[model samples]
Target: MIKIFEKRKIWYGISLAIMLIGLGFAIAFKGLNFGIDFKGGTILTFNMGEQVNQDKVQEVEKVISDFTKKYSARETNNTEIELIIQTGAIETEQVKELKTKVKEEFNLGDDYLVQEENISGSIGSELTRKAFIASILSCIAIAIYIAVRFEFEFGVAAIVALIHDLLITLSVYAILRIRINSPFIAAVMTILGYSMNDTIVIFDRIRENKKKLGKVETGELINSSISQTMRRSIYTSLSTLLTIMMMVILVPGIRELTVPLIIGIITGTYSSIFIASPIWATLRDKKDKKNPKAQYGKKKKTSEA
Candidate 1:
């Protein structure tokens, strides 16, 4: 019995506020800290020959600390610990020396070995470009598909929701200062997929219900459709969220990836229900005023003379 569509302004206001906060942080803080994947650096992956619990992680940190102290201003390593450490952009020779020193200084069990990758900022720049392209293409594809399947209004509303979800998720990163890296790109892409699916389901329902319930106000039809799908959305989002929470707790290395993914899921679900649906109803109503066929206002009956 929630007047979700009737209260569209409230949802829009809230979404705007959240986005503004994120944008404000981005502007004030100058943007998120780019990880090695974006800025380019040396990545070290290793197995400690045991479970990668907190103690093992802390031990690895101590070892890196020792290495940095000896190397002084010549080197630095940041721990993202899932058996991975990032040493800010380094030279080929410095990389070789760092590998030798890691072996000499750190004692992993005889069964273990370390791996390293030297990424250039140029490579990171390429990744950034590719990520942006992928996102834009995805939005375009979704808009086209929705327009073909539903209406132009639905397409625009869905894209608005996509922007809403991504902005809010990225805003969290900006506010929290989470490092932007390849994993962050992966998370954003994955979120787009999830957000699109959730929005599509609601859109599909609205389209179906509009057909069945003729002569109803657009807001009434949308509210009905969203109400029907509410439980499903909650179930889907909650299940995914709990799974991600568990992974973050159980896995030591991928927490960096999983945590942001969790935020994306929640926001994606919310935008689909609260933001996307309401916006669609508003758009559909406006379209109805402009053109009768472009609406859910009243269906063209089969027996019309």
Candidate 2:
């Protein structure tokens, strides 16, 4: 089998470098297009009485785009043309007006179906705040749980891995210009929980090894524990990925949700095994060095004297 954890430092360094590059892109580009969940905007979904043609859709989109451009009160720098459409619940009268205009312009009959959703600035602000709070709280809860289960160092290492996975995922979003919204928030939180679970499983094995192999090098022990747990982790992640892939490709109305889940699960699993355990081993080694009892011959000298 491939020795993934044999060069733990190199793997960790590569992951860190990818994360930093992604972070820089995010900072420089502001973010992948923050959806209306973060920055309030209107959403409209409609079907013409006749089969919708590309030419007609483009024409209608041009008019609606111009209308939004003039009426939009927010200072949005990048407002690209909107062609991709999806189904969503709408909640405002202005959306109805836009639909009416589209129908009139296209000379559509009553058979045309139109829907509109308008989110106010204040509500968007509240949603954004809640998302931020939830993410922080999740990290705190995971830290407490890990610390209680193993040790403080284990908890710290898990959190570092969690943060690393999150940043890397977000950076990809920024670079790809994916829309960030409530669903994205859900994805991030879900990944955090999943990542921590994987870390905990590995940590549990490490704890077992620590008890079994007394006085072994920390690095060697970590490597052994990780190797023992590698098969189970790969199996679990592959099963989950299969389900997510099915949803993304086969199911309608779930493409957005499944895409992020697939990305999160893959990255989360990788970080837990490679990033979290290695960092914990490194920290534990440092701690061991600081203690006289952990030295090679100190215990023997004390007993003899």
Candidate 3:
């Protein structure tokens, strides 16, 4: 028995430390690196007319760097040798000159400048708001589902674990200055669901054990439940992480999604095993303290024979 509940403070402390580090970074730094999808900017697409190699990417980045400090360049998935550049709003003549410079630099024809469009900061603001709302709503829905399926305490603990996973992921993003875009929001939503599923598995095990072992101490029951499910959780997270890592290595275009998946899986598994169960045990312990006879695992007979 790992005595997980007995060492609750250690787990909680570790999580608190991670969260604080991320918070400290966020405070010391200006904020997260919001990509054009969230911060809003102009999208410029160019067709090199040939496959864009790393050298080509570096050249495009150099050209873009001359225009705006806040910009991102990536090779698009289009079959037509596309490169997309996003940057803060620049003047009309500047856009024209940029096109000319790109054309001259690469010997590209006039039509090499495939598309140009501006995204308003207001629209980006709207997206940020919607993303926040969606996350809150999803958390609420998950809590409701877990509460109905198990107990309210379990639901709350699971939410805490999910939030912990979210904070850890965002911390990594902020620390690394990763771009937060539409794909990031989608990835976050996926992380929340994935994390919640791991938590539910452990909670399910705890609930089952509570019934089968009617007189076990709360901490012992929690430890046993976690121990029983820990292997399964580890295996599941590892398999998912391996798949995502392979995707991240093999598919460059989907790094935005795969990177977060990797972070979420590790944190999710940790929280499910170390955080959520301890929290539930603590909550149950508190409830037991409030009413001595209503201790966890103590079955009450309806009538004495």
The C-alpha lDDT values of all candidates are 0.76, 0.72, 0.81
Q: Candidate 2 has which clashing residue pairs, if any? A: none
How does candidate 3 fare on TM-score? 0.91
Candidate 2 ranges with C-alpha deviation above 4 Å: 1-6, 49-63, 66-98, 105-107, 111-114, 294-305
Ranking by TM-score: 3, 1, 2
How far is each candidate from the true structure, as Cα RMSD in Å?
A: 5.0, 6.1, 3.1
Give one digit per residue, the lDDT tens place, for model 1 in 155-262.
Answer: 999999999888898888888887777888788889988998999999898878867887777778888999999999999999989989998876635766897799
Better lDDT candidate (1, 3): 3
Write candidate 3's Cα lDDT for 1-305 as tens digits.
Answer: 77888998998999888888877888878888887777777777888878877678788778766766656677765422333344445666777787788788888876787777777789889999999999999999999999999888888998988888899888888778787878888888998988888888888888899888987778788889988988888998888888899998788878888888888888888888899988887787788789988677644557778
lDDT for position 121 in model 3: 82
Write candidate 2's Cα lDDT for 79-183 as tens digits: 211222222323355456667887788777775554446666678789989988998898999889889988898999999998888877876776676767788
Highest TM-score model number: 3
Q: What is the lDDT of residue 235 in candidate 3?
A: 91
Sort all candidates by lDDT, best to worst: 3, 1, 2
Q: Which ten residues in a row have the lowest lDDT in candidate 2?
A: 72-81
* Backbone clash count for every predicted candidate, in the order shown: 1, 0, 0
Candidate 1 lDDT trough over 10 residues, lowest sum: 70-79
